[model samples]
Target: MPETPEIPDIPAQIPALREDPETEGTQDAAGTVSGEDGDRGTAEPEAEHGDAGFDLGEPGFDHSAPVVAESLVPESVRQVAARATLPFQAARADLSFGTAFWYNDLIETGGDHEVIRQYLVTATSRTLFEIGQWTLRGDLTDPEQPVDELVMGGFAKRWKVLEGLGVAVMPTVELHLHAERKGWRWDTQEITDGLAAQADDIAAIGAEPMPAYILGHEADDSGRSAHPDRTQRLLAGEVCRPAPDAPLTWSDPLPTGFDGAPVFAALPLPDEQLKLLCLGVALPGEGGPDAPATVVAFADLRPAIHALAPHRRRHWWQRG
Candidate 1:
């Protein structure tokens, strides 16, 4: 593994608040008196003597005075009430895969964890192209923890049988995580088995394969490519198939054209065709478009894909 770069200290500019013992039991702006134990008490009613007695309808009484109502409420309670009455506004919810502890482990380890996640995704796609946006570890960990260093990427089980075959097969879900923490270990088999179990549960239900779409430019007569309708069709879930006989290829580094385009097809994998394939030949890893073909499959592939779908869907929805 390559050496991970050093992580810089995160700045903490906010000053810490210190409680002052001398101010204990002091009266606050809200007429309530706070005790040392943190409990609050209302100020004693003004000595009820003769005409000075408290009365709701007293002509000279200022009914809206802070001392009359606000002082009886604790500041914290008042703040909460104010917030509750504020207009509703939607905020993005954190949607991340894997357990919270898993993310916490990455953040705590603090080095190479992010890189490891990305590298895993890149390595797994040795045979297929990765699609969709990479998930952020920060989304899963405590908000106070810095997750700028951790990331995860995913690959679809289905690939273009041969670049433009129209028909595709999805046999598994592939996810990769990258973090730069030293002294951390990964139990590959355990992780793989857990993913397989989830996939099996999904497969048992026989759910239909989810649609996948692609967005790219079509070349003109002069070989210049443009994205006139790619964005709309891709968003509409239009299947993007390669031209017949066109070189079937995908790039690890996304194309410069569509910034957020879907890079993989979302064709569903049929249950009957989900069998594992044992290749009789080894394909060249660095070969060009004409490299010899070698079929590959793993029994756990389909289940893994199912396990990864929900997380990916969350991101997809957010993007939409």
Candidate 2:
């Protein structure tokens, strides 16, 4: 077997969850990223092994908590956030990074629920940084009754696996950089132009080789760890086009409950499929229609979720 790359060490002092401005009306105070296995539906406690100090078992791993300006947020996250031109106030202006996860309500009732497991690194700041994965374990047949659930934690434990899967973080950074420099507002024309300009670089990054550790086939291996090769290919930026017979659907500013804000955008892959991108923006105060927007979360949508409208899809949490 080939030598494996050393996994990075996670900080023992996990940051405390901070109050995010965007979490108004939601369960922000109770929302936290914990290391408990039973709460997260995991069979074992993976955080004890020291793989970045994250307990992969819990679903409510708060990715959006504000990090102190002096705290150690990932350099990659900071760099990407700094380069991107955000349209709203940042949650933490000092040193911050954004996070995105599927809303819990949508995940339980929405199609392509697995898409929520992925992590997204948007621009950094404290303006709007409370992120979590939504979870619901109760009966799905009753839509009228409120279901008790947790919505955070999948990415915290699997950060290493994501890195190994060849998800290029830098390309996203570069895209933000390019867009900011060009003064491109989050409009269709501007987004299309920016994507066209960066097509070459995106393709180059997508073609890179995936790491070997991600090549195993086992379900209990850890949150969808089975079929490593397939996962590798999918995460390696391989474009998945809609079936030729599949009807094409298009919507301007897809209704993602972002109040017509251009929070989500997509680029046409070389294969004619769309590469969906979602931006989690942090609003200044209890965000209303007039609240100024700031981007906190950034992520690429999984192929299945990317093809559908935001309203049609299920997310981990719903905005109040």
lDDT of each: 0.20, 0.22
lDDT of 2 by residue, 1-320 (tens): 32211221112211222233221122223422333221121111111213334332222222222222222222312221222221111122231222221121112212211112111222222212233232221221122223222333322332211221122111111111222222331111111111111223223223222111000011122333211111100111112213332211111111111221223323444555443332232222224324333322223222222222233222457543
* Candidate 2 Cα deviation (angstroms), residue 206: 20
Model 1, range 1-320, lDDT digits (tens) per residue?
Answer: 32222211111111122232222234332212222321111111111212223232321121111121222323322221111110000011211111110100011111211111101111123223232222222322222233222211222332223231222222111111011111121222111111111222223322232222222221122323221111112211211113332222232222222221212221123532221111011121245434322111112332332232212112345464
Candidate 1 lDDT (Cα, whole model)?
A: 0.20
TM values, all candidates: 0.19, 0.21
Best by TM-score: 2
TM-score of 2: 0.21
